[model samples]
Target: MKRLFAFLFAALMLAPAVQAAEAPDVLIRRLSTEMIDRIRADEQLQSGNLARMSELVDSVLMPHVNFQRMTALAVGRNWRGASPEQQKQLMTEFRALLLRTYAGALASAKDQSVRMKPMRADPADKEVIVRSEVVQPRGGEPIQLDYRLEKAGDGWKVFDVNVLGVWLVQTYRSQFAQEVSANGIDGLIRSLVEKNRSAGAAGTR
Candidate 1:
């Protein structure tokens, strides 16, 4: 489960930074290639060194992801019910979880490459699916990577990634909804916060 979360986080962090002047497909391929290169080159990430992996994720990945949007989707209808403070806490904890999980997955990056599929998307639509293939070593089946993209301002931002056809946000949504149902939104937020805190302490130790 942790490894699966890490793979999703790493993929999310590498979402294409679309340029105004470039086609979305071209930009996605370029950014994805660059991210793969960075992962390959980083000694700490390649070696599964946690401290450097954490730093790499914080510096290179976090800025590109829309955590607030992800949190809202994950929290489902409970997002509207939360107070501002609670909303802020939820976003913070969720962000930390992704970052930590991404660091953990850096070890699995070896010999893995992403192949961007041809985009058959309507330019007029604000939202579209961008598909790719993750080729792993050992000659097994390729993992399908589908990114859910939304036009935000002048560029397209990815809100979710589907690995091997399983949507990450949707998976989290189910878990989050269950948590909220069992203990309310506040309880869910508290649980995430405590989990983040515990992970942080464990890393320090």
Candidate 2:
């Protein structure tokens, strides 16, 4: 699962939008390929420069994601318990956690490529799931990766991801629910903050 998430960091690094109306599968495939090439050629990123990798993900990958929805979904029923301020804080901390994880994982990216599977959705559908897999360079089993996206304005925004048979939002939902149950919404925010802090410290060393 760790390796699967690592591959996800590469696959989800969608580039800046060149076409607002681009098909979801095409968008994912093109940008993932571009990112793989960029990572392979960039010495700083390959050398584990978290700052650079994080910046790259923030600038290029985040724009395509509907992070507010992702955060809300991950929080599950507990999301309604959060005040406006708490919700904002939760989003901030969760986004930081994801950014740091992706940045750290991307440092080891090499010869990893995304293989896009067939997308099944009506053209008029507002939401859809795009399936895919990570083709490892070492010829290991291909890891399953899927994306749930919603049509926003003139483009698509990813809200959830499935990696190695586990959905990202669902996995986090379980953890967030446990935290909220034990210590309330504010407690969850604090926990996320501490987690991000610990990860940031480890990255610097």
Candidate 3:
């Protein structure tokens, strides 16, 4: 449920409209609208096809996210101690975990709408947080979501998410740290791989 909440925050908030110059809020608003419409129309997504949903996330959403930072933060202080190969492995597993977790959750976007608060940031600032609310259908209460983004060379990219006041990266960081401490870094990777595989298998069932 926490993973779904985190990804729902990402899917609804991290989208960037890359057509022209814009603030982070405008970019999010534009892409969220566009992607929400696309999700609504995609029969595969409506049917909860995880493969197709992952493809959508990879093609459309991954580019706008700062996965390197996310992976490092989730790995916590143990990251610098990891070898290059281990780092790569960690990133790969972390990426797979996110894609698999969020792919299934993406289907929940059906009939959801988002509203943004005023975006506050200096034009010269390199990073900022954007806040918004997701309105679920059938008169459900709105979910509070926030995105933390930094100005990469290409443009602003999301690195962490805050859902209902809890930070996404921080949440995963604690879990990753505990898992690595118990079984080791390689064990952490294996666990993530297994979780992703289970998600995939569940999708096929």
Candidate 4:
């Protein structure tokens, strides 16, 4: 699951933001390519500077992603049980968790490049799947990647990702359920915060 999330998000995490008006496939292509190029050229990011990467994720990638939807999906049916305040907290912590994990992935991804497959979706459809491949430039086989997006107002927002046949939201749902079952939402939030803090410390070093 850790490796899956890393592969699933590495392309979108540290990229330069694209226009909201771009089609989903176009958006993925542009961002994926730009992220690879930019991350390689970026001294601080390539050196694993968490602060710089976090700033980019918060300012740039967050808007392009429907994180509220992501949090709801990850939390599953229990999402409706949370108070509005709890929901807000969950989103905050989840965002931090993803940013930290993504920063780590970006730092480690040195010889990888993203390639977009031909997109196949009707223009009238409100939901679409954008498919792509991640090339491991050093050798071996490419990875299968797909972004599941839904129309949100004028732009499409990514809510879940499928990598090598496993959906990221589904992968986390079981973990979240276990935590919620044992300790509840606040417990889950606390867990995320602590993990992110530890990851942050590692990133700084």
Candidate 5:
């Protein structure tokens, strides 16, 4: 699961705020290429500078993703039961967790490029799947990576990802559901808080 999450972070790369006019597949291909080039050229990023990577991710990647939707999906049915404030807290903590993990993945990225497969979606569709793979260094087996994106007013926002046939939202759904079941929404929030806190401490050390 951890490896798959890493694959997802690597596959997303560093995407700048996207233009609404760009096609989803085009967006993926362009950003994937850009990220590979940037990683290869930047010594600080290649060395795994967490702070720099985290800042880049916030500025470049967050705008392209629908993290609130992702948090709701991961929380499953419990999403409807939580108060608005709880939902907000959940989103905050969940975003922190993902951001921390993504920063770590970015720092470790080296000599990796993404290969995008042909996407089959109608021009009028509101949601689409963009398929791709990560070509690892030294001729390693390419890992299958896919994205689920929905058309927002500004542009397409990625909501979920699939790695090695396992959808990220589904993978976390069961675990999050268990957490919510055992301790309620606040409990789940506390769990995510502790996780992000631990990751933050570890990164600083």
Candidate 6:
């Protein structure tokens, strides 16, 4: 559960957006506006009182993400070596990890706003870095957010995020590699399942 939540927060730090001629601020504002409206309209989510934030996150945020591609990249060379069954298991676990993560992080979405920085680059570039700040109501300080985006067919998709300068995909790659090395793929799967089960039990209470 902790791992999943970590991943979702990392993702939120770098939300995806189209790579049109539109300015970064315009894209960010559009996404933020849509999200706020969805939050208010969903009865199940609104009544869940933050507990149900996961539902909203899963429905709205998950659609824009490319988790399958992200997982393949994270697995790196190991993905090529994995058998069909192993590949399937890895995808399942990865998806669950993100789902549980989205649920938890959305629950904590208090009064927050995003400030997008100016975009500076040619449209032909294969990648663009979208910078923003997540301002919280508590007034501690704004969190630095950076989205590493890649040009997909007719659009730009987020492949990685850095929060307060910490790159999420890199962090998971290191940790996941260590776990696989220490316990093997089966061991890693077991660990994810156990953690997910525990989180489910807790959510019920």
Top of the candidates by TM-score: 2
Give a tens-digit lDDT track for model 4, residues 110-192. 56777888989998888899998878766868888899999877578899898888888898899999999999988988888
Ten residues in sequence with the least summed lDDT for candidate 5: 2-11
lDDT of 3 at 15: 52
C-alpha TM-scores of all predictions: 0.86, 0.93, 0.89, 0.89, 0.91, 0.77
Using TM-score, rank the candidates from best to worst.
Answer: 2, 5, 4, 3, 1, 6
List runs of model 5 lying over 4 Å from the truth: 1-4, 10-13
**Reference-based lDDT, each prediction:** 0.72, 0.80, 0.75, 0.79, 0.81, 0.61
Q: Residues 102-169, candidate 2, lDDT per residue (tens digit)?
A: 66666555678788898899999999998988887779788788988888885888899898788999
Please count the clashing residue pairs in each candidate, in the order shown.
0, 0, 0, 0, 0, 1
Steric clash pairs (candidate 3):
none
Candidate 5 clashes between residue pairs 3 or more apart in a chain or in different chains: none
Point out where model 1 deviates above 4 Å: 1-8, 11-18, 48-63, 201-205
Q: Predictions ranked by lDDT, top down?
A: 5, 2, 4, 3, 1, 6
- The digit string of per-residue lDDT tens for model 5 on 1-205 reads 4544654664454766789888989877877777777777888876667777667766776778888899999999999999999999998898778767766666445666788898999999999999998887789998888999999988888899898899989988998999989999999999999999999899788
**What RMSD does each model have against the real structure?**
2.6, 1.6, 2.4, 2.1, 1.9, 4.2
Question: Please, what are the lDDT tens digits per residue for candidate 1 over residues 55-84?
Answer: 655665644456678789988899999999
Can you give the lDDT of residue 135 in candidate 6? 68
Using lDDT as the measure, the top candidate is: 5
lDDT of 2 at 46: 60
Which stretches in model 3 have alpha-carbon errors above 4 Å? 2-20
